[model samples]
Target: MNTTRGADGKRTGRDETAEERADRMWVELIQEVRVAQTGVQILFGFLLTVVFTPAFARLAHTDRVIYIVTVVLGAAATGALIGPVSLHRLVSGRRVKPQAVSLASRLTFVGLVLLLATMTSSLLLVLRVATQADYVLLLVAVVVLWYLLCWFGWPLWVRHRHTSEQ
Candidate 1:
């Protein structure tokens, strides 16, 4: 559906109806959701298994804090990532998909942010455990920088540089 800047929240572009834009947005939303869902599931699985290890019991207080924080972040990410599927199933055929897609996109963004925190903290905990070397913090810092660049920085840069031309 095409949308206009009127009081009604009709679809935004051309003369496409809300249903049409909803359909298109639904497809795009599902594709993005799939990728996020997979990562969150895998990370959640790994986080759950970490508790079974004896080393987990021996973790220092600070490491334990990291573990707990990582688990919470993973849980939040999982919830946000899976929210769209449930949203879709419940609202199917209700003609609310464009709205749902927008909401889902917001949830996915939040999930990604949580995922970033989860991965960073997880790496911090792991590297600290794996290396007693003086460079452990430095190593984690490098990895964090890599993640920030690849995941967030590059995307924003590309969006800023190209989106304007569009």
Candidate 2:
């Protein structure tokens, strides 16, 4: 068995070569992507149906524009989230798991960002339609802040606070 200090200088306590590490990371990344992929795919599917609703024609020009933007964001999110699968398929057995993992991680991160935008836009459209009030943007801003805090801020804070410098 072998052990090595990781980025934070803590011993990983695992006997794994670079290829093994890449394999493990790839599996974990794929699992995480599956969860995000489901959400984004469902959201995109729902967005696709909005245009067919009779009420869609009655929406104000601003609301319609918002819908278009939201749908585009949703599509982008779906594409990014699913990109890893396609990437893996194309690169499988090429002895490049390490590079594939790195690229897949980047794609997942982009997907998450796109997902955030889609959610914000969808919420804005919903609130505007449900309540024609000036406070809608304020509410959307608050929600976006909450999402950022939960999705990125807290994790970063934890990493910064707990990680040891070497």
Candidate 3:
């Protein structure tokens, strides 16, 4: 087997030579991060405003805990999502783009996971306050499953299927 190295002496791509596919994956990852950052930022900003709302004063103790957890998770998501930018900035000309991109990708994944938690808790708080349905927990569980499927399950499935076919 032959392998190529980038300027920084690091192997690039998915254990293959750095080629068009690696470039495309990098672009896709950056795009995904952009979309996620936008959503998390907006959601986090809204969560920040909730503390000042009149209704916040009337929230039950459990609801308040949920709100706090959601806010903290949102903050963590924001940090992780923005991490790529900082990573790129610091290493922009270090001739280690491949390594930086890999690290940034991990940060983005962590951010997405945090974002999922934030969204779940946020939804739970909203639904719990909006109604007294006995199936609220079930509804949340369903939505979580949906997120896991869309965010992770589908991607992993595609990766495995493609690898097997190849």
Against the true structure, what is each candidate's TM-score?
Answer: 0.84, 0.93, 0.85
Model 2 poorest 10 in a row by lDDT: 1-10
Ranking by lDDT: 2, 3, 1
Scored by Cα lDDT, where does model 1 land? 0.83
Better of 1 and 2 by TM-score: 2
Clash count for candidate 2 is 0
* 1-166: candidate 2 lDDT, tens digit per residue: 4555576767766678777788999999999999999999998999999999999999999999999999999999999999999999999999999899999999999999999999999999999999999999999999999999998999999999987654
Flag the better candidate by lDDT, 1 or 2. 2
Query: Is candidate 1 or 3 superior in TM-score?
Result: 3
Candidate 2 lDDT score at position 63? 98
Q: What's the lDDT for all of these models?
A: 0.83, 0.93, 0.88
Ranked by lDDT, the better of candidates 2 and 3 is 2
lDDT of 1 by residue, 42-154 (tens): 98899999999989998999888989999999999999989888988998888777788888889888888888888888888888888857887888889889988988899
Candidate 3 lDDT over 1-166, as tens digits, reads 3465556776643455554445556678889899999999999999999999999999999999999999999999999999988987898777677777889899999999999999999999999999857888999999999999999999999988774321
Which prediction has the highest lDDT against the true structure? 2
| Model 1 stretches with alpha carbons more than 4 Å out | 1-16, 164-166
